[model samples]
Target: MRLSTYEIILPLVGTDEKPIEGYTLLTNGLYGAVDVVPKEDADKLQAGDFAGLPAALRERLMLRGHITRKDEAGELADLKLLSRIFKTIQGRSGVGLVIMPTYDCNFRCPYCFEQHRLKKGQDWLDNTMSDEMIETVFDALKDYRARGYMVNGCSFYGGEPFLAKNLGVVKKIADKCREMDLSMGAITNGYDLETYLDFIEEYKLRSLQVTVDGTAELNDRRRLHKDGLPTYDRILRNVELALQRGVRVNLRVNVGKENLHGMKDLIDDLKARGFIAKEEERAKEEEELRKTDPQAKTKRGQFSYYFKATTDDAHPEKNISEQDTIDEMMKIGFTAEEAVARQSQYNMIWNRMKNLFKKEGYPDFSPAYCGAEMGMLVVDPFGKVFSCWDVVGKDDQATGYIQPGMSRFLWNFNKAKWRTRTVDLIPACQSCPYAFICRGGCASRSSNAYDDYFREFCGEIREIFAFTASRLAGQEWEKRRAAAAAGEASMDACAGELTLSLAGPASRFTEAERAKIMETNSQKEMFDIVKGAAFFPEPE
Candidate 1:
């Protein structure tokens, strides 16, 4: 038997505030199984000397697939098989349709990533989607349904899809969506949302992602209009109107070094406007409601917000690191947990892995990072189709296009290239322990960084994973410690029970074969170690 190549070992702390002598928290990133084990046994297995460990411990490890038979099909092959299975399942699920009416925007944000497309002047900006093109897009959706793929929903996107000029186009799309029985949503700046309120109410608009970077003063300094006008009051008022009309609002804060410290002021403004409530206020209200109504439940708010670090490759100096943003959030009265949850894209992978561990003790296998590779079709104003939203206006990046007369999509080689950019195809990710979890990171970012889509764009993933695992291990250790202190079961008993529940069947290798395998490779190569380190500041 041999140790799995996908295991991460972290030192476990004891109840007495000291590092446990020889115990370590071992987590298999591929399987998402976590356990506490003796460091000596782990070392033995790492050295291909599994027979030196106790039989019970060895059996438990084998059951969890942490230790496998030497002759068994390798983990890389298993990963590839899982990738193929996931891709097949996703293909049969549905397709996401993104409609970009125009690439023109009233506001000129300093850190906008679409500046490359926006700088093409009025002639290019005036190329809005015509009524005929809208019909063709729906026709394409019809073709997708005919191919047995469900039309999931339509999301409005663009330089700004909710601009006053696009209201007619927006209504046409909404009318079509209603006829087709598909839901509608949008990612807008919220400046002209008032103009679309009638449309929103008529169609039961599912959701709107609107950005409110900071307080009025700070936000206007960042997200300003082309005519150099302040946009905070107008956007906030429209957002409130949308929420009142029963549409869910996701208020996004594009955090940068300049506005990172202004989040507290923005939160205060939200609370003042009754858009958000303090934890204590919410608790008191819930308690009062329960007294009056036996079946009373806390009201679910129509609006929510999250902080996302700005991505501006042109001006790297203007960007704020995620850790710094989270630190500032904690300083502004957010708990460690709250801060972690509110930070949007930074901890997405870590959050997914953590939630899966809680729900299933293992993560669902993922072949690709996002819907772009699976079934997302982003159609720009000119009917240019792109797999990823990041490369929407770039002609070379477009995977296909929808002609006025063609009912079916005219796909090119780029679509196949995107569809096949799975974790298995990336050389560096093929044998990496965190391949399934990270899924080779963002495809657009990878292409930009390495100038090749196939190259891996790691982007601080190792540090993020190590930090998250360390925090989880610390929490688990404390939970066990607390349970023992209350005259409950001992730590060893708790660990054994957890192992049995997580581990499945016995090893495929027999005793004789296992012993021979162990003795053959006395100096086996160790898996890459990710040290348990803190990337974010610890809460006081």
Candidate 2:
């Protein structure tokens, strides 16, 4: 079955003629799937919008404004600043380093992209970055700094970011960055988040993300230990601790077929735990007070939030009944972890939110999911640069290097003739409307000289995009019952759904281009696939 769940908020909530615009998300729970949909006005939609939608599900929509996908040369809104700083500092959009302290993982998730990298086998008891090697990365960073710009802050990526034994060295690297580092963040699996809560709080991490695939059964099924055993108990325990510790968690979920039905389960669980609601009245007040008084004593705030951390002045009145469930969950010894994870359960169809902004006079429509354009970079602990782990080190995934004593390696770049050959470049993606935003997708999926399987891989992505678009357009009129809370608005432009079509200026091709290119051309096919990947479920 298909679900076109959307998150929308219109100012004219009380009016019978409320306007609607934004993208929608289409989910295929059968496959634990998700994808982006195009935007449509509330008035533009036909009565068919309500065809298959159940009445109880209509009022839970969550909507948001759009973000930018253009260069940062001119001053833009603060939200675009995230991407602007990335390109400005690194001469590209995504130049932050994603240093994996280690490849060793404690658990095994079925869908993990790095499953081939193995969860264990590497001796964690001694495997770690040495002081000398750590300095090598830092020394190389100087070259990045010389490139002129504070690349996106450092990214700690790994089997589990905190599980790396060199936690102390990672700390030192962060400290050194104080003189030139932009900011620091992480994408951990949430296994050791509690044990390392101090690092999160101490660094005041910009975004410390953790992934939990689904509710207990599905989550355990998708994400588990090396022995194929469930790890729900410990992971949840850690999440509980992290939440109580005051560290904001970017809970990540990669929905797939097996966990499709778990959506409501997770949402219900979080609501019951209060982890998704405002903190106790006291906690909400403390959160407000903390803004002015850093020295204020630790007091629980009145509210805890599970809303999108955005620049938009939009807040939906959380479900009142949902709030009550949280109160109940707390009484039985269930920790805030359930709430934290559950908060992410709301099936937000980004299309509605994006369409909302489009109707609000959005200025630009650059598609920006995440990448390393020039100003942005993803650095590995070993000092190598990549767009992101999902896009680097493949046979076709290498751009440049920030070597210790080197001026820097431009690897292979010549924009004017960037595609003299088809294999080295994707002749199909240049013309994509989402091209600028997706940057030819990931480098590994290139078909020309990059990967022999580029076509097949990208073909799969295109299929996903097509599925999402239909859903968003199909649900044009259905309205949710909730209203925007307070204080969440923004000024960024809305880029509609990034389709997987080969239509932008990037699609031109030479007659013999295919014959001249090598089979290992990696960057070619990967670009288009990732643009539409905003909805891609990560490996469990």
Candidate 3:
């Protein structure tokens, strides 16, 4: 009879047996022990029941399961530990994916990379994706079951994706997604707006970053048809109709010196419509609420906060501070009283936001991620899978295209390719300092604007980041203001309230003392000081 010896590890969650430094534990403090058993009886005295032990030893035997498939209990525990560890490290959550259905565009905008398609002329058309070709795309997505990703379905695009005259195409895709109940939608520049009305309302198109080159005269000049005809008026009409029907519309402007003038006009047009819709919706909601709860009176500027990036890099109250917003409000409203009133409301909104930020987590914060890393396989209108939307029609170096049926190409990158892509990846496109949450900016736009994929629109992004962060900070400030807004209170009451909110009451402990206390009491501090530390945070 053969004899086998095995040592089992027991995890000690609540013990002094902490891990050593640098080498973090895959499993926690496991007590040590070994057992000798006959091969024929190996299964009987394994894990839960081990052979030959005193009652005290039996209670604390620390049976670390075998690291093999023969120990089914050990194997199951290993898998569970693996799953837990994976979740902790990878987050393993699905992110939103945007599939550009087509790069074929109607308008030949001077700024658009899509115009490059027009410049390349028939080459893009020859390569354009047909409706039938899309089936292969869908099937390829199905083949990726082994990888843990869910395709949110395709976001149709094009030389105006509508140019396909594929109304049935959307319905067919929508029908399949409806059966599967997937998030499917499309982006269009509104050439065939009326036809796609039903699809927009029904599908609830998640995103619509439609390109608006400039104003009526400027836009018409920029976004021209195949024969170089103006399209601003037609597109605007379509946008208006879509908005009226409650289609989600994000008025996008590619800001350059030429079109900066048109942006304000575009905003004015959209805002008037938006405010009118807001008023109607507000009234409807109020009526319904009155019928139901009746006690929700939203103060002015409650929907959105108003604030500007300040000199201190903090979002503060606007009283006597934000002159730019005041000036802009006048232009947006086109009346002095209207401007002043709106500015006041905006200031109040900002105040409320600042107050909220003091105690709450980041609110309405959308991370600015480099869309490339998130597994968005954007197949241009011709069914060419390009990574960068703006890189479409260019050479494979600039454009992110791959052959059909080759591979769905999961975003999990190789080191050589990652380095190469990173070299191609503009430093500006590097992981944002805030990308532990906010992703970096778009690689394609950076490449197109600067001709360096690694270089970024840093100034634009910094301003946006500051602006976004300030708004978040402003929310916290608002909460502080409200807490302080309590009219008449005793000195003790005020002191107590303030002390409760602040990290360490000024009256109780000094900063050094508090810091020591935090370091000592914090769980992270408790475990980190131990022998081994295995994990590191994901790259920022």
Per-candidate clashes come to: 0, 95, 54
Local accuracy of candidate 1 as per-residue lDDT tens digits, 279-390: 3455576689889897664443257788988877777788877777778987887765577678775457546645654543335567687788788989999999998898
- Candidate with top lDDT is 1
User: Residue by residue across 1-540, what tens digits does model 3's lDDT show?
Assistant: 111122221211111123222211111111111122232223333433445434433332232222212343332232222223223223223323444444555566554445546666565464545556556555555555335555555566665666546676566656655654566656677767778776776775544545565567776765667677767767766766666555455554444434434546665655564644664576576677678777753221112112232221111131123345445545554343233233332343344334433434212122223345434455554445555455555555333333456445333232123123321133432323322122234455455456755444433433332332233332222344456576543333322111111101111333454344334634334234221222232244
TM-score of each: 0.82, 0.54, 0.55
Which segments of model 1 are wrong by more than 4 Å? 11-23, 38-49, 70-73, 278-301, 358-362, 473-493, 496-540
How much lDDT does candidate 1 score?
0.74
The order by descending lDDT is 1, 2, 3
Give the Cα error of residue 116 in candidate 2, in Å: 2.4
Candidates 2 and 3: which is better by lDDT?
2
Greater-TM-score candidate between 1 and 3: 1
Candidate 2 TM-score over all chains jointly: 0.54
- Against the true structure, candidate 3 reaches a TM-score of 0.55
Residue-level lDDT of model 2, residues 70-166, one tens digit each, is: 2222112222222222222223323456676655667766555565455335653235555665666666666766755355577777656687355
RMSD of 2: 14.5
Report the Cα lDDT for residue 462, model 3.
Answer: 34
